[model samples]
Target chain A: MIQTVYIIGIGLIGGSLAKDIKKSRPDITIHGIDTSAQHLNEALELGIIDEKTTVEAIDKADLIILSTPVDAAVKLLPMLLDRVSDFGLVVDVGSTKSEICKVANAHAKRRNFLAMHPIAGTEFSGPKAAVANLFQQKTNIVCEIEKTAFKLQEKALNLFASLGMRMRYMHPESHDKHIAYMSHLSHISAFMLGKTVIEKEKNERDIFDMAGSGFESTVRLAKSSPAMWTPIFKQNKDNVIETLQEYISNLTHFKTLLESDDFEGVYKEMDETNYIKQILNGIQ
Target chain B: MIQTVYIIGIGLIGGSLAKDIKKSRPDITIHGIDTSAQHLNEALELGIIDEKTTVEAIDKADLIILSTPVDAAVKLLPMLLDRVSDFGLVVDVGSTKSEICKVANAHAKRRNFLAMHPIAGTEFSGPKAAVANLFQQKTNIVCEIEKTAFKLQEKALNLFASLGMRMRYMHPESHDKHIAYMSHLSHISAFMLGKTVIEKEKNERDIFDMAGSGFESTVRLAKSSPAMWTPIFKQNKDNVIETLQEYISNLTHFKTLLESDDFEGVYKEMDETNYIKQILNGIQ
Candidate 1:
């Protein structure tokens, strides 16, 4: 039943979805909307979307994806809910979900929207970085799926399923908190690790010359877009702060063990953390 | 001139080097030695080494590679240097250098020893995890090169270069200090990051279900062998402590910016750290 697709943010997540959906559903027309006219233009030239349109023409869309930064999505969701056609369904792919879900909850047309986050990305961002098959075998976390009308849920779920995503449903608050540990804290850890090393690279020129692939993998997330991450951290401030405190405490405890020559404790700590190997095996 | 390679620790690095050398230098035989008899057996079964070796038979080798844990290597280097033939070259692949180099310096056969740390590895360890070509395009940091005889240096350098590695030379003290920032801190950061998230996962069941590839990459080093890292930290305690202090301070500062709601500061910090993208580009 979904025919015309309107993606509100033509960035990495949005553009990638457009590319995948276009490949699978050639009969469907894809309309890309971005505040940056240049992005809309690039999306068109990249063949990611078939048309360009704005909020004024949103009612024509059978499926509308809200893929802006979390803050932008929060502000835009209510306005979008007010304008979408009765048959149209809206879904968001924001990293944080609590704030966006709260905004949607207050809307009269609450049943029209679904809050979902697909755990997929690279350090790179924007339309040019978009690629097909980004979502294959990736977990799609859907929050408050019961709030959306059952038929409209099918349309959205079908979209994700058709693209090879496995959906896991949860509450919006749970999504924000769990993601703080698994995703947000990892980003902060990487960014700060890069900052610490870059600060050292200033006084010593050859530090990077000795840096190996381990350094590269651990700091890879430091290259993520500030525009995308800053808002997620801001929105989930308390949870993120909680995770950071735990991380810093662990690092400080490690420093103490090293300072006091309690290498046995240090070894035990890392050996224990190596349990992540089993967890990561399950992930991959 | 190198015919027999006596590898003292048949773990990831030593076993990997043996596999590659055996492939490219079919005329040469690789003799495996390890505290773990199971590892020696695994190396033989995996075709990573040609013969079993002991220190008593070390003089038969033209090249001796000491690839033990840093603590073990510090204790073993002097013993190997004492027993090595005048024409035999001994080089170590210890993660920390100052201690090992100091140990080698006090010995009469110091010129027969070289201190090197090839920055290539995986989270896995031991002979069963070894793979050929792990050193291809990787950095091999050689410290105290001036202490090595010209011919012995060529013997070691040719071995690394033939395996397709790029070499960087530095003093032992400088190598430890720089690598503490470049390599050691990243491991601690990752191990501690893994520890914190695992603690949270105790209460939150679905935390990793939301973890993306970013989280996995950032914490991959947490899976590295604690036996290997514990000695590296012990041998370079002062440098590791300094880098950990810097890393903790940066994380605390970022948390403060988030707590104080300085979205602008948070954004600026990450934006500045994004410079790592360009630096990493140069590396790959």
Candidate 2:
């Protein structure tokens, strides 16, 4: 029964959600807000939003979605909650939720806000990269759902359900820790792999010719936007650092095993890790 | 014009080659050989080979392909050459070439053997994983091609061409060095990532719920067969170790930057690595 939706940061996640909302609830008008005027114009032209508006104009919106970078969301969430009408629901889709949730914890209108992390995205960015159904069957982790009003929680849940997302709930702290290992660490690994290979293979042609699908897949996330990720690494710095330490320790141990010519040890390690196949199948 | 072809180690790579060869040249008779009776029987039942034969029975084959693990290929290449007629060609599809090529370098019939590494494969293994057109438009690196007889080289080249492969030449040493960065290091990185994440995330359901396509792609190669990769790591030990050191160093540097709150440094590193998008596009 929402009449108006205001999506801040009209980039990939926000733009995609707008596309889905427009398709499922055509009666609801979508307003887009972005720091980049170009992105807002592009979203309007692409029909991703019905109009462009600012924070002051969103006071009348029944639903306000903050899809900006994690750092921006940390600053914007409390402010957005202050401006929202009593019946208006505010949600922030930031990758790291602990800091944002902590910032808004003692706010007078805390129940108006929900923190969510949608586990969906491509390496591509910008409004042009957005597509319908990006969240189809994808996991959407809602942190601190208890802090939100029950009616607003049901409204957000229904919207995500309409978009075909599977919902899971966690505390902001647990969500950050688990995601630091599963999601953020994977991006760092891929970026480092890309840097190592690019630095070693001075002859780029050689990388193109010799590299196969394995290299391509392992390094795919290296292409993600710096603007989006830098803020994420900053917000989730402690968990990310801890995970990187463990990952580096593991890599160093593997190097020692290889250096010592313990072929049997290396073989057994890979054989054990192959169980990831079964785990990955569950995600699919 | 190959009247009969014998493929040793009838597993993923060999079985795939047999499938492509049969499609391109239906008149060519395909024979498969393997130390494992189960593999040989499966290859025959799947029609990946017209017959299952012993090494002794390959004496009359117009072409003999050794598609075994690197260690096995090193042992089989020299012996397979001794049994081939002067008109017959012997080639290996092993991942590492320097050791295998060096082992066969002084054989009397060295001119009859060619060392090849097709830059292809999936995480899956065995004959059932084989599929047609696996090598179509894929790069085939032929090491020590100059050591083979010109007529035999033409025969091998034409056969690979028939299967729609694009050919490239490199000395075994250069091939090993380049592939250590582009190929071998990628596998180790993926395997270690999988190991690290698996160790930290004891609850597999948490990983399943949080992991997205990025995690799936980054860890894909961890599922590769250990029997195939262990020898690869052992044979290219020095180069693999060197690459591992550089990779670890780069990762450590990234961690240091993160610890120092050098957000700009971390941002620039990922931005530079984003050039991998162009490099990966070339691969596709």
Candidate 3:
């Protein structure tokens, strides 16, 4: 019975979801909203959405997807919950979940909102970067699922499954904490690595040619859009700080091992971390 | 003029070179040597070499590839130089350049050795990980090329070109310093990032499901062989320490930005680092 969908933020995540949703339920009419009129136009040209509309027209939709940055999502969730139809569901696909879930919990129509953090993305962004199968077999972490109306939750879960997502239920604060280690720290590590190399390469431009596939893979996340990531860090500041401290501590210990001529300790450190291969084997 | 080739170490780099060299120069006899007898046997069984021979008999080889770990290479280069035929060319493909080059520079047969480091490899290692054309379009950094005899250098250069390598001439010290930022720091960052996330996952084993392609890419190098990487970090300690200090400083600054709610600063940091896309586009 989910016949109409209104998607706010016609960027990579929203536009990609629109593509998959359209394929799964072709009869559903889709509307897209964004601060950039150009993105809405791009989504329409890409056939990711059927029409372009503002937030005011969302009430007529069966689903409202708020895929903006976490800060924007935080401000819009309460307003979206207020304007959503009795049968309509509101979902926010922000990176950090706790703040938005807290805001929604305080709203009168809290049961209409579902806080989600779908851990699927490439370094690329924008409507044009949207692809149909981006979410295929990707994990969709659903936070505060109990706060949503049971029927709306069922519809959301079914829609996600139809789009080929593996759904995992999580509470908001815990979701933020775990993600700070898994996802946020990775982005920061890549950004800082890129910054370090870029700073060095400025003086020795020839060093650029020396970077192989290893450097490229490690720094690929550094190419992600800052507009989307800055707010994620701002929202999950404490957890991010904690992860950074741990990462820096590990690096400092590595330096100490190197300084002390302890190749065995260095080897042991890397040997233990090799377990990540197993953990990530379950993923990509 | 090259008929017999001796590839010491007989692991990933040595075995891979053996594959490409065999394809290019079908008449040459490839002899494999390794500290691990199993690796030498694996190389022989895989057809990466025509024979598994002892290093004492390297006098018959026209080209001797010292592809062992840095510590082993440092110890063996002088002895190999002592035993090599007058026309034989000894090339060490260790990751660090300065230490091996320094050791080779003092040898009586310095004119018979070429210091080389091919900046190409996957995270996988061992003779079994060897693949044909692995060095295709890869950068091979040659240090102290002038120290090798002109005829031997010509043979090695032409042989390398035949295997589809692009050779860049660099001083050993400069190569180590730049590689510290470009390549060594990447491995350390990936290993430490993996360590940080793995430590967190021990408490909540379910967090492994939350990892995405981004985490996978950033942590990919953590799976690299510690036996190989330990000697690399040991040989390039000072440069690696300097690069780590700079990287840690950058991560700390990012944390400070998050602490003070400076979303704008965070955006600028990532936005600036996003230039890595263009830099990396030249590579991979």
List ranges where model 2 is wrong by over 4 Å.
none
Task: Report how far residue A41 has shifted in candidate 1, in Å.
Answer: 1.4
lDDT of 2 at B253: 95
lDDT by residue for model 3 over B80-107, one digit each (tens)? 9999999999999989999888888788
Task: Report the poorest 10 consecutive residues by lDDT, candidate 3 chain B.
Answer: B275-284
- Distance from true position, residue B194, model 1, in Å? 0.7
List fnat per candidate, in order: 0.93, 0.85, 0.93
The DockQ of each candidate is 0.91, 0.85, 0.87
Q: Residues B74-180, candidate 2, lDDT per residue (tens digit)? A: 88877788889988988899889888888888799988888898998999889999988989889999987788899889987998998988898888898999899
In CAPRI terms, model 3 is classed as high
> Over 4 Å off in model 1, which ranges?
none
TM-score of chain B of each: 0.98, 0.98, 0.98
RMSD of each: 1.0, 1.1, 1.4
Clashes, model 2: 0
Better of 1 and 3 by lDDT: 1
Q: Please write out the lDDT profile of model 1 over residues B1-284, one tens digit for every residue.
A: 89989999999999889988888799999998999999999999888888887889998879999998988888888778878899999999888989998888899888999989899998899998888899999889998899899899998799789998899988989899899999999999999999999998976556678889999999999999999989999989999999999999999999999999999999999999999998888887
